[model samples]
Target chain A: MSAVAKTLDVKGLNCPLPIVKTAQAIKELAAGDLLEILATDPGAVPDFNAWTKSTGNELVEQSEEAGVYRFVVKKKG
Target chain B: MDDSQGTLSLVLFSGTDDKLSSASILTAGAAALGRKVNLFLQYWALENFQKDRIAKDHGVSKDAEPEGASLMRLMREQGSTQHWADTFRQAKEIGDVHLYACALSMEMFGITKDDLDPLIDGVWGVASFMLEADGPVVFI
Candidate 1:
């Protein structure tokens, strides 16, 4: 597993906010850095997928446990 | 990264909290995906942008009467929902989002640019808004 440069906890935020904050947080990371996001919104699953694809970032890992959705995205090099 | 997803133009005609919140969410989502978002505030929507009224309660739309209105109020009281203005601010911070007041509406309300909250970029005529719309405009 690649090292995560940052972990964004957006557990309580609703739709758009989780993705919005992720977009803002990922901007501060260097290329190739990994951003692990923890979100409670079920929408995050599909939101992250579309976000990564549209923004050209790599969704290196994704999983859900006990209703919490986790995603590890690597900034495009 | 493809920041060229094109512009999403929105016409905000309703001033209700629920409507504004919905529009704000759409703006933020579009912005997060690297799309430019242009919001044209008109009629009641433009009136709500006044600096003194922006933070006040604008209430829910008529469609959300009775139980639905109370649910929204409860969420807001619980601090579970973000204010629409703040959402728009964050959207602008992270992407190409611009808010403009309709010039005709401004004249109707007798409000100058300074009367509005700083969140609004400027006052624009219908022609100017259409020129930048670039695609189908969504009215809220």
Candidate 2:
């Protein structure tokens, strides 16, 4: 069964803000929880990937729709 | 390959309000992730190494700014203005981070050891800081 998910819309935010806010939000979730992020910054992909790698978090799904970048991040550690 | 041995050294040259704040945030974030991080401050960034002068220059505790650029404003805009001194201090304590002052810059600025903050690990030339930067080194 899939785990519960939470969403955070950080549109218009730039580098470090998106990552830092995502980190703060993810920390509040339990293991296996999903974080759905909506960001408009072009730097989110690389930044989030690095954040997940370093933090042991899992990037479950990522895609863009209508100029808004969306990512589903699974909380690991 | 095992990823445990990699180290990231950053040579932060620009002391501009925007760049230095961002650099500090990046270093702190990497240190938080258990990475071996070294930050070599040169040129204007070296001003941040001084004790009484650092706070006065950066206006960290004073809630002031230098001329047109506000150090606090820039970092706050990026959501990285908080607990900077503490972040550096924590990184130093955990052994994941090393803060160094560039000897050449120090000499050019007529600054000596006594003028620098005690948190600084050591002063080194370009070659010394370059040795540990095998993985990735960013010049800001």
Candidate 3:
């Protein structure tokens, strides 16, 4: 995928907060823009996937290292 | 799944902070997923909805008291000052979420809107809520 157009830093935040912040951040981007999120909440893994599925956004990549989960999501066109 | 018109409903019976945290998390998720959410508060949940009681109502369920206290302490240690109230408020801001205090509970407790946090949408009964909610409802 192309380079991310925006990044959301939600480290140290918990469930619903990270997802909530992601939703708000995604709203600011235009269609097809990429969103990068950094989160630490253990629930964030499945939460992001579910949010993308239900919101019709695309979660292109995800990874975890040192307890931090990173995700790249593409907004629906 | 992006059907924005879909709905998720909650019947909140417990007033404990742990349950509230879980319920609010689910509410926020549904809202983020573009679904409307309806929260029906009764009994203890209704009583806890009072504006003055919200801040101080931070106990978990009695059965899990030991674990709950430690977990709460851990969350506090990790800088988790965000409460379920904040979650519910943000859910409303992000999507179409409505909160109702059961009239039956209200009558029993002699409660009014003036007693509740402003986040409550209105007072409603079970029948009307059932008819209007066209989605899954979970009791918390």
Candidate 4:
């Protein structure tokens, strides 16, 4: 299946920004697309889960490399 | 999900000051479900509703401490009042949460409107806040 990809740079943004921006980005994308979020804020873990659950989106991958935190979310139809 | 599930208004009355996770959880839950949410910030919590003061450094994980420190020595060791306005500010930025400062609480604390944070949508007395509370309200 072909999927679209989008990236949101949310570094320096605190707890809700990363989540809020991620939700907004997913809202603009089509289903089956990937939303990659880069955030330095450590609060993104639980925050993203809460966001995905609330919005019916799918969080496919989450990891931290060096000091940068990254998450991949799939948009809901 | 029912888009029109009426509305929920949360009235937070406490001296807990800036720890907003409790309030955030309620507001976020409502917002997530696309429900109308109103959060009234009273007492010291109103200090968190300001825009300029909010952006200031409030340290980290300070809000983790709940009301009435079970272990005083432990709390002091853990650093009481670390002040995390960032998290609170984040909750405000997320859409669908309505924040207000309690007028009675403000007067009790001798806080003028200028003393309050600008992010506060409006200031209201108990009567105004209570009207919404009757519909569907949760006290945090």
Q: Which lDDT tens digits does candidate 2 get at residues B1-140?
A: 11374777888776554566567677656654557788898987787668875554353322233444564566557753454554466455534678889999999999898898877889988898888788768887
Candidate 4 CAPRI category:
incorrect
| Best first by TM-score, ranked | 1, 3, 4, 2
Residue B35 C-alpha lDDT in model 4: 60
State the TM-score of candidate 2 restricted to chain B: 0.76
Q: Give the alpha carbon lDDT tens digit for every residue of A1-72 in model 3.
A: 598999999998887789999988888999999999999888999999888888899999999999999999
Candidate 1 lDDT over residue span A1-77, tens digit each: 87899999999778888999999999999999999999998888999999888888999999999999999999998
Q: Which stretches of candidate 1 lie over 4 Å from their true place?
A: B1-3
lDDT of each: 0.92, 0.72, 0.88, 0.64
lDDT of 3 by residue, B7-125 (tens): 78799999998888889888988899898888999999889889999877468999878888778767867775478888999988888889999999999999988999998989998
Candidate 2 residue pairs that clash: none
The residue-level lDDT of candidate 4 at B13 comes to 57
Model 3 lDDT at residue B11: 97
TM-score of chain B of each: 0.95, 0.76, 0.92, 0.63
The order by descending lDDT is 1, 3, 2, 4
Displacement of residue B67 (Cα, Å) in model 1 is 2.2
lDDT of 4 by residue, A1-77 (tens): 34438889988765445665665566677788888899987877887876677667788888999999888888777
Per-model TM-score versus the true fold? 0.97, 0.57, 0.90, 0.58
Lowest lDDT sum, 10 consecutive residues, model 3 chain A, at: A12-21
Give me candidate 1's interface root-mean-square deviation: 1.0
Model number with the top TM-score:
1
Off by over 4 Å in 4: A7-21, A27-33, A36-77, B17-19, B47-84
Indicate whether candidate 2 or candidate 4 has the larger lDDT: 2
Overall local distance difference test of candidate 2? 0.72
**Candidate 2: deviation at residue A67, Å?**
3.9
